[model samples]
Target: MCDRMPLLGMFPSQKRSPPLTIMNLTKLHPFLLLGSFCLASLATCDTAKANDVVGPLVGAVESTSANFLYRVGESEQPLRLSVLLDGDVVQAVDSIGRQEDDFVAKFSISNLRPDTRYHYQITNTKTGETLIEADEQHAFRTANPARHGNRVSVGFVSCVDIEPNGIWKEMQGLDLDTVCLMGDTPYIDSTDLKKVRTRHREFLQMPDLAELAANTPVVGTWDDHDFGLNNGNGHNLMEGKVDTRRGFVNYRAHSQFGNGKEGVYHRVDLGMIEVFFLDPRYFSQTEPSPVDPTQPTCFGAEQWEWLLTGLRESKAPFKVLAFGAIWEDKKNFETDDMFTYWYERDALLDVVKNENIGGVVLLGGDIHVARHLIHPQRVGYDLHDFVISPGHKRTITELDVFHPSLEWSLVEGWQFLTLTADGTQAEPTLTAEFRQPDGVVNRQVKLPLASLTAVDSSKPDSGLRAHWSFDGDLKNQSVLGDRVDAVAVNDALVVTDGGVSGGALKLDRSREQFARVPRSFLDDNSNHHTVSLWFKPTSLPAHGTSERHFLLESTAEGTESAKSAWHLSLGMRSSEDASKVNLQLFTHTLQPATEIGAAPAAKAQGGFDALVDREALLGRWNHVVLAFDSSSLTLTLNDKQIAKHPLPVPGPASEFGGLIIGGHRVGAGRNFDGWIDEVSIWQGEMPAETK
Candidate 1:
């Protein structure tokens, strides 16, 4: 219902209040006032009370298994707990004593069946009084197994300053197996351990949140607001320079932080997906010298090593790296993010690239908005980071600035994300859906597992018409046996190291170089064909130049004015807009000369042009596929369709010249300065297997 409400309505235009302080509470509407009142009243209860149970039974779930860790509030009387599966009491405990000051009781239940649902209840054993009756049964489902080919859905959100009553209702109805609170779950922002604990109790006392937590397993880490101050890091100063790191670990369910460190960083493995809960606030030092390897880093040495080891060791089909803040550097904001420690961040990505680790995705929170960003050409693939925040709080309108790497962003209403991993096919697929409080899906994207994996050209497929691996030679290794030797135009076109495959042909910008074949492999006018290749641009055209850098082209032998038969070129629209380059595919024929001396012009040219907007990072290999059928032409980048356009007319069938690589013509100015490898031409639409 608040989807249409103005973003400013969520946060009044006034001076901010400190965390745990209720100066802004009186400004909230009646509904929020009632909710806050109930939470405060429950959280303020005395811990030594005999029958009064504060912060009743709460469960922290395992990442990828059917295990649960249950925690409860202070209770003097001995308590009895029971867990039921399919209406049968499968596990039970009695006379469990509460811990020290908080008198909280902790229990761990393990070895349950995967994907199975269970109900739990608690009672006082001394007086046979049911503190939590079976009627209010809390139900939860275990994580799904990877081998079962089932879909595992996990929901995530952050920045729940003031509980939105409807948000939890929406989450409860989603029936997610696991819910990850990325950060700012409760705005404690206090160095006092007692105050922090009380704030967590207040958060748990919310009716909707409590109901959702009871029925669904919850996992989380903390951000600045919950870790003591706004934008606070490991060096944050409280009373007497005391950091709130201890308070964060004490109140949360995380049993371990890295190797004796107090930070709350951990990893959870759910059947096919592994989620890495990162702590960037705690253990992070201020920006150090970029070149100083011994300087303090964002993730200390131990945690960083653990993360690398886990990533290298994980065999899961997907890895979700969850953070409490934005991953990339935002131009407008002066905040603590991965950008501040670019060296360490790049080093982490280098491990993935060098180790050839696949199926990695980033998740973030604390921006108070939801958006999808792509770190262009990180390692071998384009790394995607999804940021979701302000679970039920007000969204920020001014934060909606245009980011070149941003794919989709929402600055208005509150939203949550549901990522579902499906391992039913040959390759696992992950689908992320962002939905509103009313259960309406705002955006959805399905990413294939192959996107994160290395380019494996070893697979055999029957649909492959032509494949130029370019390992050591320009031989076509397709079933058709259409082999063509490379005719190098200049010395600059030579085999070089650093390829997705083996050796790739390198083209220099300062020199004129290209390779051509003797026969026309793509001369067929069937209107169903695919051309796929790997390319890495060394440099973009100068700012005010309409220079056309041809990666591949085919033309008939004629005079200098003769039109190109067909070409795939990277060029700017005009001199004024040279920054916006376009990768265009032109298909047509040269008009027949009226007389022997007359020059030939273009007959009928109609193809597609896709803007090389984001994924075109310099010095990184990029996979591109230009596929067309009888109806439309689709341009795929890194295994995802980036652009598609319907053909206005059927492609013209002309006697084409040989295939040209790295230049427009043999002696033309349109020369490419990059590396090209793994060139393939298919007679029909490119199959998923080929990609």
Candidate 2:
């Protein structure tokens, strides 16, 4: 072999060419020759012709066996190749079939030892010539098997484009056993294969990157950019089988990963760690109209089954699931990006919680930034979502907003992690390192595994409360007319005509106006609590055109109180046509909506044909205070509880959004129009009428 080669220390004639190019090559590498022409016998092939048919190398990937893969032709073909494992000659058949096309070939080398180093070269079996004279020698390493007494370390990275100065070099010192490639590997423009190939070359040519892959095995899964379009999901493809096969062909041929099926998803064991890689794009469903949160799904039936079976049967100490995109929150719940298959996530969470499955950590990429999310028992099971994403080599994008349970969500430079294990105990250290292309670490943060799990649930859960100043001044407090204030009268705030005035506060004159308070303000630093607000309306509207007055309001709408969970409002009329006035207090869980308060059959008095008479409030101010404890919502009129309603079972906060005060424009619905005063807010129900 040494006498026949040039790139390696084989042949004397194939000496070093300082500025080597395809045109100057004396012979085509055996791998390129086999790729260019389907010649059964490599001995008679023309090395010159092979050199002329050169293209960009793309989808450069390594398999579980640590065999490196690359695409150099229209088809992902099986190329005749020779490899040096730990500096030893290991001639093998590095061929994987080209799926869905003739021009593309899927090449892969399997059955290799773990934690081993290997150097490889591609050449034509016939003529001893190199295809790209300069790219003759490249190296890679296989992943170490997850064995007993082994402390396997791994780093995860995702979302990268072709950039000159990348952080790949600094990420190398992370001391990893496996590198999780979480998609968006290359910017496959879908329209241009050249760009795709160029992107692949950008990563391969990086000396730092080459060293990393040569030292650590890479496991991968693809997202939109690497697959084709920007947000392309399932069903997106290039024209004809030729181009369509090119995308996945390059990915499959170049990466060491292999799936039982065609899509890029698989599993591997790293001592105590077993990772389940998921490809959510393939099984995505056509987004439904009106968007339903209860039914969002990413994994199709078959994939879900496969994932479940694998999880149920795995014997590893920890199940580390690598998701290519965000799972806890869908892209756009209200529009096209909404998920239609939520059953799978729910089922998975159920299994993890109920089955007592410990050490289950979900890792995701695709948001462009890194964040750690912990979903505690707000209403369901508590779990940890440990995510770390280095979208670009130089991270500069903000991915998420402020979250109360967030451990660390930052947009700095790239990140790398080292996870060591001792039996059932695994310690993961994540380093948010800001580094340069030359391997200089600027700023770094080393987070221990305890930071990932030791969260305190002692803080009071976040709720609404009510009180009265009773200043006896009615100015600038009214919901209508700017400067309509109302002051405290004895123990209750007095409301007359303008109610409370001044301070640029205005009320809805066209309808009955009331005041509003935010539920978040009422949250008593705890997950659950009670709230109450006091209101006084001078007069209820007799005409249906006048909007109903609101003591409290929320975004959720519908006749069902369950739909509008945790809302406390007092309104007259159901819609534009309803004549009866209904006073109500409601809470919503995942259950249904329920309402408390009597509905009038006819308008109230004062020219009212149905429901209660407006005459009841025509000439006097009525004191109404609503209070909520852990179990019930009590409405008090004149210091006496008139309506006591049971609270709904605790559940997801549905129909909750921005807070609205005074009268709300209920589009073809009922609007609130009445005066409100003596609004005292607290985190919990007003001190239970002090014994």
Candidate 3:
């Protein structure tokens, strides 16, 4: 057993021999053709002498069980597998024939000793000829059942087209417990079943990788490129979705494919470390909102719940959340990773934070760069995303953009990460090392499990609950670091200079622009609160028009005015006297079960609202405040108290949604065309000045 954790026994970079000359090195970063890997493997196997077999490829090896896969030509002798323990036969499983399905056979064996090394040989049961003709004997070891005894590690590889790809050889010697082919492992951008399956096999069966996979377990989920298209999503993204998924499943063996239903998201437990491999492409839906908030899904609903429930129930000391897409906010709702699926992303982090799931480290690929991104105060701890991409050299297109949370990045490509988990120590830690093919370490991070589980981001704090001084980034700045940062929907929000402070978020009415707030800040018990902000509206409709401009809203699209949980806007009063900018506060006091309800008469309405108007409140920077003290709600404009009304409800209201700023979520006509700066919120009461 490997007892040394990365942190406890830090090994400095080793001396390397002279660099192997790579072909076609260029100034714009070199490209390694896909032929390199296949050609290298073919040369080693000698095509004419490879027998009738493609593999004795091994997979899904656990503490007591193992699975094997292979594709062979016309051969009658059914293969038999022998598990050799020190030259003595310990256990064996005979291959089942299914020649019609492309000469494929599978072998499954159980009751193997844990943490013990054993050699394996596939032989013709009738002919008595050993099928494995490799130069070296093939072998594998089982996982340790002792959950916290030895250190466990997995190396991540993706976008695997680098030539002179010595990284495979580097990993060949590590004897890692598992290997995660993060995504784009085979680069199949077509839905053709044959191409998809063949590419996967070639990558997995590459000579340098073949021996390693036979010894160490290989697990994977797919990204866009390997998922059969670039930026593909939804249920019908692929022509034959079933076959595309089967191509992955048939070529590589995972403990379970998805939840035994749809998708490929699965959990792999390695000693004290458990990795949740997410299938971002399979179940993703296109949610174009101010949405039907509940309609948009990335993990779909099933996988979303499965992930949350699993995280909530997981007992592993180190839990790794693996995504085929990067965690950075790219704002390209149609194609980018987590940012487009902000709801699920935030929801997952919220669960990890609220439930105190410690030792949660995030992993990502599909962006051809090696990076360590630090998200400050994420779930009570500074969350870090370790990203590795381009198994060799450069990629077709490197996903580039400096996220606000970037700690460091090295784009020399040729990158992979060694994710090691050590739970034997008092403070178990998950260490991630982003390294290159040349044995150079770009960055390494070792975070303690205790640090991750300690903070309570949702455990209510006094005073300022939220503050957003755009200030070049969108992170929530408050005394309490709840990790509830704002999300810019549809690339609609951007921070610009010359605000009330350093910078302010700019939104245009011509585009779909708004910042989505987390649900926690607008919970049911948040009636007693103060909200203040500075804004300058650059665009507005004529006074007599029926168009209402929403500045802050929680209403779902295609819902009735009375159905919205809350809507704060600037609208007309009556055409005859609609001469000024009227600030309207609308909210529903709902039945406990529902957020939407039937219209109620003015006085019969349950929650408090007001129509406070000011003639000179447009085209210039102005300060506005909305203060509610449970009993009453007050509206103030430019340091002047405009209106104070008793708390009542117009209709049913449920805290079932999130807040959006600088526009109504549904359309551009109702969006606030403005610059909003220094938005702040206090949970307990109104600010002293307002009172």
Candidate 4:
């Protein structure tokens, strides 16, 4: 079956009538012609009934859920409803009474899981025995949890209309936690209930969306078309703000948008990450870009204040500030399609800079194209900006290059970002190698935290360290088998063996293993302190189960016994070859334990690898440092700070006991087999890297 409804041409009737020929029109009496038309109308109605007429896509949200407004057809009949989960029928309702032209029915599904998928459909109850005969399944996912980690992937889209294949395929592969629809999901250009129903129904049939809804979590807000007439502003709706409010009401009822207040903006946590969804239409004052300060506002007074406060108070490591408008630094007024409202943008930017906040990312979609921008200046707070726009439905034209700080622009093609984070550092590496749907190749750029901080330094005191640090094996200054460049060249502290190369660092494997160890190991004197390190192995295996390496302390001796002065050493797995990270900071009997970390690939340069493999790590070098304050621990890698958290500092009890680097493993009680150097420990925090 094609699974599509036949469109009613020029005029719609309950029944199909034979096309009238010239002879029939000329010879037929008026009465006879009228009778034939009446018969045809009846037949058309019968066929519609037999085919299971499906119309109206109502969405309602209320106290008990049934109270939500519904987008229903103006028909005097009850509907058969079937709710599904991933194309499987879960619940069905039948034998409902016919509703008046304006009436709506109600049902509630409680006990729904947050961030999960589901499907549903409705049919004419009077004509079919099944609750919903051949009703196509529409999919949906719940909202995210409130608190999560530092990294998250979210999808945004707008300007959606009836199309050949749907956006769902592209959506599913992204593996996102949430989907933000920035308007035009349905292209309803009229206030007429029928037009809205038709558009909604067609959208429900989109398989891509149906599948997506059944799987990923979804959050939607409206734009002009779905809410009102073309280019709709709040004042233009039929019921004005009332209609706008109702549309939102219906949208919320259908989607997983949380409902304390009725509008689109809301915040939720996905794992360790938190996100704030913005609703610009309802509260917005400006229609087009050059925002009129004297005119009404967008985001209204209340929303503006709320957003400001929310951004300031957010505890998540990363924040995604999003909107519907285009955010191009340089505008093309001739196209009349660029972000507006500079005053508002500046206000938001001001809040971020002044707050001394980190990990804030901006997102938006509207141009029907994907774009990425890295602001050399953080607009307000000497901060750098990383912004991306991945639009939907439209085939991208060319790759656009933008270097605001460098002052040049290039059109490479459409692009996306693969961002990685580990509490301390987050890297957004652009891979232009991945083509857009239209098959255009773009360039990929990698941006590290170190670069961003130096380029966008807002603080006057540039002397303090960033936040984290790394101290690996005592080889050269590099963490991996790379050469030791100067602090000016590469800011991280250096650890190196006396000679060039020719030695292997092996782990003391025979011992008990704890997924995470505390920094108390360094507190030999029972005093509290934090410790961190970065390491590189001479050789690595892609797949294996045994063979471990050590760059720092181990607890293989025994769980409770701190027996031997020959306490512990660090560890690394040979299977994970290349480079690795070990960051542990713990308190003594008095305080708490906290850790922050990240590991980069060990790059081979010059005679580094060759010498390290055959001789002492001559060309190879690694950095190892232990910096602690009485209350906190800080770790860094390659000069880029990693994490700073409260923990028990190393004690003075170890003054009599020697500090060991490649000593015996903690639990295994075996010695580490690797070259060591540049071992340094400070009673105070290490000096901050240069901006």
Candidate 5:
């Protein structure tokens, strides 16, 4: 048996009256007709019945707000809605039926606290009588921001169809503060306003769905199907498209359908994160071209300007931009996807880069798959894109192809994503989890927060030279003229725990694991220089061990007896006290032997050793600096000068052959074990103390 009330005026009465044709009723105002129908129904039935009122589904949930829309499925007399928050009457609104919509009643509530959970119930009253009431209390939570020193989790999904068993149950299990419906929320491909409204009513009436909707706030945007047709765009002229847009506006609270305008683009701030919901379907141009400047567009000029301005002005730690179609140009059959609109997409990216907007993550759906992408070669920092789809519909099987920036991809699955932000530290952290339909987390990735925050790279005297943070890749992040490629030896060196963020490289002691760069980049040995790095040793060579473990060495290729221009190593301070380990800095200047009277004097070496305290170099990450001035060489540990030695012979040191990390350039000995990060070489003097 259908749970829906018949819309064709099939009220039970003692005597049958002539049927009122809907066409004839068009002459009367919709509200008048609605009122007349209600009065006639009431005259034929008992007004004391409690089953006449249908629903009070919750929608348009914001970080600190909520709105409820309900309808009197059969009631004729005016009804009053009483909303209770935590057992206290917070609001009571009498139904102004047909004034807003023919049969719907809307109650908007706001000014609530963020991250707070509230339980609520709605009751329908008429003439001092309670006719309908909520079966049970429902709960909802406000969006939590990371700036409040709290962690926030948000779940997102797309492409769901009205079904007996929808994924709403699974979504509720995620315990998310807010749920984003990325589009295709309902499979209502119709042009009739009545049909669209009916589909929405049927879908929301599902038992589990009703419970979830009433308790959890839902924010959504629409795609083609929900907009009245498949591949619907700005050119859609179907009779129902306008009504579909109207229904969306009436249903969702956070949506920004411009005052008397048509687009559903809006922004919501969830504490430390700001989410921008875009209208990719309504105002989109027909068949946008990437190469032509005069062609159509995805987000028209107005929306594009609005989006860029919002992003620029937002102070949130994380910014999420969401839309209905895939952001990348997969070159599939869908011409409306972001790829075909590359010009607009690239323009947005340019603004993000040029304006120094950080924490901007792109979210999208409609592909019926889940994937993560990294566009590493973008204008500024790399852009991370995440896609989750098939919120409840059947998945489609497709082959996944390899792309340079494709981190992970999968097909034929019903899944959603949870993005959690941790803002407890100076640099906030965000973690994204891809979960299965059963609420099991399938894959997770933690992004370095510093990358999400834009930095002014144009500053001079930032003291950044050859910096290698070793964050996922080996490319130099500095602009000091030299860009060197680092190669991992034996593939044994992998990124491991222990840098400031993503982690550092772990050089296994058992294997001949090390990394190396070219000598040409660091050939400026003639100037005052400073080299600093963070390293943690698993174990220091016991006191008298003859082997010298080199953490970094810039030297000319030669046998064991050869000298290096500069090196930081752990070795015995002479064979006498071989049982004690010392962090040593070696700087040498070689001069050809000159013999006026004799044949040729042996090559003379001039240098000094600045030894660091051995105890500070083991177990924990220690910041060591080897700085050189014209007259002296200094070794600092954790910003405090520990050792200083006057240069025995220092005019201008000669250039070394190559730079080797974790070991010597030419030998397997002097291998370093453990973690190393933030290796930098400066061509000027370094201060004894740094923040």
Candidate 6:
């Protein structure tokens, strides 16, 4: 699945309009035509409520200062913030030049205490009129002092909907350091300034959102819908850019707003992690011609420069590059993901690799599905991309995406991702959980601090024992670089393109199958050697035809003297759901037999089963490894150790006559039906980890 494009026929978003050709917007500015309507809009706002006040919405809380955004009356005017900390009057914020601005001004309240809640309200400076009521719901707190070992948890959700949403209520009960509105806090894909500002007010005033903002600091950026229009780029919405930007800066509160001029690109530090919120849609191009030299860029020119500079200067252990689009190449007709801008993305990634920047994680939204992808050595390290999305809508189930980098993905339930950085450990770790209000976690993964650093990807650490790359012919690309005497046992295997590395061996279960490797690695003296291979399953999970979908097996087959060996396979579960596939590893500790075929007895030998989910297997090449040492044997799926079994004695492998790939030698329906590539073996130990 490395370079596969999403079929896209199965994908269609009703929220977005169809893409259009480039239009000349030089003489088509909407602001000129709508200039007269601003006054009428203000009169309409005044008649709706006589003396209305919008918010004391809180943002960008530090140990000493915090920013308060709100609106009073109808037009731009001078305003003051009345602050109270523990019933004592506090010094007002510094307003030397920004006392009188727009209706919504980001009041920077300074000289405050740390880790303390301060109650505040907005007032008119000229008339000394009280604009807001004295309510504790209008309170905000300063953050704890900045330190390396601070324990911080941040919750990120995107694509806020107009209809009722469960995540907004679910987030209020959780105590998070900060809540990020990744994009589309409200689905107002409008080009009207009046409507944009009005919708932003409604979004901030929602009961659940208002409550969460009162207690916890909020920071965010804009995506397509909120940026101007759905899939709107600079070429299409040249007129609305200024108005939409003004609305964004006036409404959303952030620690920094990218020089306070162009795009909502900023950085927010929560505990040990620093999140660089990127604006991928603000300056995006209209066309999909990624190879063109003179087309518009995704992040524009200025924003791209800022992004690279920020990454170079960051010192935090974990630097999260936040965007509104999913990082995978999955795209549709409506809009493009980061994959369309591969040149720019690769440039940014190459900077991280060449400069040796460590602990960088990519975070994105807007895919409508929760996913965890490990791009294999796109950088020097296997970069982890954790996607959070579709805060209101149910996840899109029709996207049958197959990307080599995708390790984990889910389309069930309504949830948001919570990332916590435990900075107090010897090796600080970043943990992400797919969470719901019911405390149900669909998936959870933890990354050690040292896992995201630089390493030599070309030179693997394990001592190579044998290797096979099936590109029309069996060739060993290991140190030996010799021809492997491998053959199709039944002439059913054929070379198939679209493999992870190159052409791969494809097999069909209905036909005579499996490739026989003469002089198998097990024939050597080493008993603890490891075997790993990349497999792409093509057949659907079977309910009754057979259970064991063998990928690699070296057993006695009731013919040879072998007694104890290993078999790596996919076992069908007992449940009615056929999609819930489980990865299985069967090993003969000390006993042996050929009677246990499909349903091996639970007593004869030990087996470990881990849910790999059939969705991950079909149409995608996944790295599967069996690491066995003297102490234990472990099974890995997509570089993650899923199952392990302990051995009472050493040398548990069965002494089979030879090795078989893609199927059990004697089975009719157990042969694998898909592609296989980069089959490898290591004698002593896997070099720290597999590629």
TM-scores of all candidate predictions against the true structure: 0.59, 0.54, 0.64, 0.45, 0.58, 0.60
True-structure lDDT of candidate 2 = 0.44
Local distance difference test scores for all models: 0.63, 0.44, 0.63, 0.39, 0.61, 0.64
lDDT tens digits by residue: candidate 1, 542-626: 6566667777776553212245555333232323444456666666532322431122233445546666653354678888887
Tell me how far the alpha carbon of residue 90 in candidate 3 is from the true structure, in angstroms, after superposition. Answer: 2.7
Tell me the deviation in Å of residue 224 in model 1.
0.5
Question: Where is model 5 more than 4 Å wrong at Cα?
Answer: 1-55, 74-86, 94-102, 113-115, 129-136, 144-146, 164-166, 238-240, 286-293, 377-379, 399-402, 425-427, 459-691
lDDT of 2 by residue, 1-691 (tens): 2122223222222112222234433364555333334211111123323222222222232224534443344434445555566456664554532543333333356676665666666654344444222222245555455544445555667776544224444455555556667777655656465555445544443334544553345556776667666666554442321242254545343342334344566776764567787876654542321122333245655566667787878766556777667654332322112122333554565566445455566677666667775544321223456555564545635346433235566575454333344442355433334333345544444444344332232322211122333244423221111211232211222333344332212344343333332222222112233333334444455565544555545433221222333343445543344444556444432321121111101111111112343555444445655554534555665566666665435332222322334443231134344445455433344444421
User: Model 4 scores what on Cα lDDT?
Assistant: 0.39
Writing each residue's lDDT as its tens digit, candidate 5 over 203-296 gives 5554455556666767778887788877777765434567888777655645356435767888777776677988887766644434344556
Q: Which candidate order results from sorting by lDDT in descending order?
A: 6, 3, 1, 5, 2, 4
Error of 3 at 81 (Å): 1.9
- Candidate 5: worst 10 consecutive residues by lDDT? 593-602
lDDT of 4 by residue, 1-691 (tens): 1122222222122123222223433454554334223211111222232112222232321111211122233344555556566667665554232342223344345454555555555555666432222233334444444343234555556666654332345556666555556566666766666556446545543434534543354555666667655545544452554444444444343433324443566654443345566665555533322333443454656667667777777765556666555444222321111223334554566466556565565655444455554432342222323233333334433424222222122222223333333233344321212223333334344434333332233343221211112233323221111111111111212233332243222332232211212122121222333344434434332234444444444232222225432222334333233333223332222211121111111111111011112122223555545444534444454454555544333222221122334433243332333343333332224434421
Greater-lDDT candidate between 1 and 2: 1
The regions of model 1 sitting more than 4 angstroms off are: 1-58, 63-75, 86-88, 93-101, 134-136, 238-243, 258-261, 286-294, 425-427, 456-691
Error of 4 at 370 (Å): 2.0
Off by over 4 Å in 3: 1-53, 74-77, 133-137, 162-164, 259-262, 286-294, 331-336, 395-398, 457-691
lDDT of 6: 0.64
User: Looking at candidate 4, what is the lDDT of residue 108?
Assistant: 47
In model 1, the number of clashes is: 2
Query: Which lDDT value does model 6 have at 80?
Result: 73
Off by over 4 Å in 6: 1-52, 75-77, 82-86, 94-102, 110-117, 126-136, 144-147, 286-295, 456-691
TM-score of 3: 0.64
